[model samples]
Target: MDRSSGGRDRILRPVIRQFDLKDLPAIVEIDREVGGGYSPELFMTFHEYHPQTMLVAEAAGGVVGIVIGFKHTPLEGRIFWLAVKPAHQGRGIGRSLLSAILRIFSRLGAVSATLEVRIGNRRAQSLYASMGFVVDNVIPSYYSDGEAALIMRKIL
Candidate 1:
């Protein structure tokens, strides 16, 4: 599969939009599918904290991807989470979601953005790198399972 396009077999282009309360379940499902341990409350709290930066990618009437980000300073932002349904992975949904969120961050006066990715998640690392994010440092045991995290940053 060409991870960038939907492929000939799939025809729907995911529409990126603000996250809605109704889309919480789909977001949670995607999180779980991607090995995240976040609870529904965590996601809800993120949405409540910054609903404008919380985004979802909808395709064929269903949420296929989600991203949660927030401004940390006047010129700095962080992307807390970004995931796409397993079946929808490599179909440009994650890319679209990231692009949309970056746009939102840029408009909010973000001069740079940061995110932490699991050291083992090479696919996501590739995506982030392609977006101009570079590994800044390594955080030891950043996850509950004792996995280290790679801190990535991109100057806009």
Candidate 2:
């Protein structure tokens, strides 16, 4: 998606595509930069079991964003993680990745999609809300750091 604000200064259009094994390093780096702290092994596991739901956003010839999700049950999909390189954030890459994953989930026959967001992350909450996800519940001490999480869901 092209996130340029106006004419005469076009931004690089991000191309959303399936995750490639070669994108592992870049994806890990983006997650680290975004303070996600997710292990590379987690991504590899998702790739192994749910390759269709793992996607990356490429811009300027580099991987700038990624989303990992899966249809955990016949009627539900779960979004495990999403991150955009700090330098590439606020330009729609994260949103594009999210939209792509949600579409994949719908195509995979999910009736609903769900995700968890840190309570303190209002930005993420807002984005998810804008994408039709509503807060379904809250999990106390959900994170290793003792932070609570908001469970959000959307009907696919």
Alpha carbon deviation, residue 50, candidate 2 (Å): 0.6
Per-residue CA lDDT of model 2 for 64-104, tens digit only, reads 99999988899999999999888876767778999999998
Per-model TM-score, in order, reads 0.91, 0.92
Q: Go through the candidates in order and give the clash count of each.
A: 0, 0
**Candidate 1 lDDT tens digits, 48-119:** 999989999999679999999999999988999898888877777888999899999999999999999999
What C-alpha lDDT values do all the predictions have?
0.90, 0.90
Worst 10 residues of 2 by lDDT: 1-10
Candidate of highest TM-score: 2
Predicted structure 1, TM vs. truth: 0.91
Q: How many residue pairs clash in model 2?
A: 0
TM-score computed on alpha carbons, candidate 2: 0.92
The lowest-lDDT stretch of 10 consecutive residues in candidate 1 is 3-12
Pairs clashing in candidate 1?
none
